[model samples]
Target: MTKFNKTLLAAAVALASTQTFAAGFQLNSQSATGLGRAMAGDAIIADNASVLARNPAAMALFDEKALSIGATYADVNVEVTDAQFLGQDLGSIDNAAEGKFIPNAYYINPVNEQFAFGFAAFSNFGTGADLTPLTEVEGTISPVDLLGNTEVATINLNASMSYRINDALSLGLGIDLIQGSGKLSRGSLVEVEADGWAVGGIVGLAYEINENHRLGLSYRISPEMQASGDIMYLGTEFEDINIPLADIAQLAGYHQLTEKFAIHYTAQWSQWSSFDSITLENPSSPEQILKDYHWKDSWFLSLGATYDINDRWTVRAGIASDKGVVDEQSSLSIPDSDRIWYSAGFSYNFSEKSSIDFGYTLVVGEKVHVEEKNAILLPIDAYTESGANYFSIQYNYTF
Candidate 1:
């Protein structure tokens, strides 16, 4: 590999290792009905079997067997402007944040009046980024190797059971089978790929104040995910690197003010604090310290209202604000910032036992100024603009 490409690869790894995309590489497009309300009351809204993925305790609200299948498409746009490297102008470049389709499915069956069992297949986190635009700079001797792509994907399979204590309370427990994989490439100078599986668990509780009000709380624990794979860099191979995921906690409330109108809210916290740094080790050589992410915990809040327009149609609207995990450690690879969500949707009940839900969301992110310092090259100051539009549709059936 050319020396110029080598340096560029090093710089790319430094920026990409810690932050990939979607608010520190976490995905929020899990449910179509939930997205319609910006995920408001995600844990307490037991309108369908999708609740099994969000809060298993909500399964107590079901009296019959049900199934839910859905898909969400995210169209993301990101741009990096006014980038300077070693006092040289690199101009503006747009990142390839292509549209991604995320799919989900769930099944729930009631064993008795007070017991329910459920299974779900869903994706909780994912990201992909292409920086090929950075390779077209006019300079001949590129001091950095930022010409590569990175991608990460994960799927979660869960089995859960809920027990209704009485008319007003319920409890739930679940086990998660998480599958994950990742790939990073830097112009043939460095290529790394890995895949793994991990075990986690979820616990939840739900309380009903009356026919019109409900409250729910849930927590998810993520086990350490170790990816055993080979890495080829500079004509050398390294094996068995580890990657860790984070846990989450959620609280939600649902209130029906009248027969036709209802309101809901939620508060969610992600344990991003657990991700302090990115370290890659080699058995025969020194460790490669890519970055010190220094990310703090993150929070999300959402508020929504539902209006029953008619017997067969229901409309919903919502708003949400999500706090960024990286306060000062932002980079081009992630470029995550505080964001707001505006959403709207409608559900059509085709029959007593079947329904379809459609939702649309617009995500707007705050502009961020980044100043990344490099050991081999001068510091670069850049401005980033990021946003996304999401559309989703879900089908629900009850028997």
Candidate 2:
């Protein structure tokens, strides 16, 4: 590889470290029912075993053992327009990150009226994008460092226990065993891959004001994960680097106005401020900064309603505003911005013991502008338009 390419490659590697397109790389695809309602009142619904994934305290609302299995397909489209690299006009790259599938499962067992146990498995953060258009310089043979292809995936397993203290109050606790992995490749010259595990915990509380009103609160404490991986640059190896994940907290509520109508709301916060930078180091030297994230804390708010049409059919609708975490620092890897969500869904009860749910959501992001200079003296200026679509299906069985 050429010297100019090496410099550009370093910048690409740095930017790729923190470029997550989905609300700063945190996921809200835990349950299909939640997706139908734009994730409103996720912690208090307690309609199925999927509630174990959001708030274990909700398990106290169940009287029987139950299981839920679901999957979501996220189709994302990102476009870069009027891109200028070192003052050269380059048109655009469409569908930067196309389609990704996320799957989840949960189970709950109520041993008695006051005690319940449950478990859940799901994906918290994942992304994939291609930006090879920025790797080549216009009208020259020299290397220009733009973003390239990158992929990241994480899986979280949780086991929880809930105690019903009385008719109106419940408390829950759980532990998390998270596994994360990722890879970054820049023009075949620089490739780095790594995988590791991290431990975390969750605490939740739920209160029933009456038969028609309920409230819930939950907090997730996820510590930074230090991944031990090999970083290869131009055939040189740098082993033992660190990667970080953020923490989150949420408050949710559910209200039933009549026998056939109900509403839900949720307010969620993510601690993106904890993630300031990415560092990589070897056993022989001190740590080096890959990139500076400098992200700010963010919030998500949602409201939803459900209508019962008959004994077996129900419909749902909702809207939400999800804040972006980027703090004046946007890159070519993925343009991060605030998003608006519109969603709808339906459920059909096959019998008293089984049911099926389908949900869809549309996410539209505010236009974002980017202008940044890498160490190679190349400047990347571009405007990005981004959006996403989600389709999900879930099945619940009570025994």
Best by TM-score: 2
> Model 2: clashing residue pairs?
none
Per-residue lDDT tens digits for candidate 2, residues 251-285, read: 99999999999999999999978777766667788
C-alpha RMSD values across all candidates: 4.7, 4.7
How many residue pairs clash in all the candidates, one count each?
Answer: 4, 0
What's the TM-score of each model vs. the native? 0.91, 0.92
> Please, what are the lDDT tens digits per residue for candidate 1 over residues 1-399?
101111122223344522333455667778889889998988998988888877999999999999999999988777777776666777776756677888999999999989999999998877666765655676633324444576666788999999999999999999988776667776666677666566789999999999999999999986544344646665667553434445889999999999999999999998878766555566787876555667788888999999998889999999999888776666555567888999999999999999999989898888888776554645566787777888999999999
- lDDT computed for candidate 2: 0.78
Identify the candidate with maximal lDDT.
Answer: 2
lDDT against the true structure, per candidate, is: 0.76, 0.78
